[model samples]
Target: MSSAAIFVNIFALSCLVISLIKDRAKTKQSLLVAVKSFFRILPIVLIIIIFIGLLLGFVPLDLISKTMGEQAGFGGVILIASVGAILHIPALIAFPLAASLLKGGASVAAVAAFITTLTMIGTVTLPLEIKELGKKMALLRNGVSFIFAIIIALIMGMML
Candidate 1:
């Protein structure tokens, strides 16, 4: 297992033991609630992973790299930033995709733009965000994220 997995296991066990000692009567209920939440979200997480795997399997990374690798000044940056805006993959998928693109010769700018936008800007989650934070806030947040993603991408391209 990964170090993260080991850490999580240790943390969980420690929490369980601590809870049992501190409040034996509440331990079972706490565990049950945790399990319930996990199960509730498991399906959504599984679906996203499956979708990401499929996208990686089908899409040609070589093509992406060739297209986005161009350092055609601002045009390439715009292309990458726009593509990142369109692709709504989650963080888990974005990291792997960015790694693959990097390996396939994609520029640092493209990978950085893709990663930033993938997490900060989301069309799929926009509706929910709009409902929770109001339309104006949601719009402003996405707009700012979009601009900052490009800026970050450009910075990485220059720095790295």
Candidate 2:
């Protein structure tokens, strides 16, 4: 494991020990809730993992590169941002996907746009958002997010 992983583990363990010492009953209850939440999300998480694995395995690297590599330019960024906005994937699943895309020869800009839009925009939930936040607000939020995502991606591409 990396040093960062080791540090995080130690920190979590320390915090858990402190929680146990401060209040065993509450700590136990919290642990139960955490376990239940983990199991509740496990199925979807596994499905996403499997799907991404299959996609990466089946999709040729050359094709991925041709679509999202440095040579692909802003068009690639826009394409990935649109796809990200439309997909209803959890952000937890996106990090690994981004890494895979990078390894598959995707440009930094495209990957950045994908992550930003995946986290910021929600085309799948736009209807509900519109109902709750009003049509103008919902549209504005998504539109602004999409634009900024692209900008952020381009900046990251230049910097990285």
The model with the greatest TM-score is 2
| Poorest 10 consecutive residues by lDDT, candidate 2 | 47-56
lDDT of 2: 0.93
Q: List candidate 1 stretches off by more than 4 Å.
A: 1-62
The TM-scores, one per candidate, come to 0.64, 0.87
lDDT, candidates in the order shown: 0.80, 0.93
Which residue runs does candidate 2 get wrong by more than 4 Å? none
lDDT of 2 by residue, 1-160 (tens): 9998899999989999999999999999989998998998898888877977887899999899999999899899999999999898888888888988998899999999999999999888899999999999999999999999999999999999
Could you tell me the lDDT of residue 136 within candidate 1? 100
TM-score of model 2 relative to the true fold?
A: 0.87
Residue-level lDDT for 14 in candidate 1 = 98
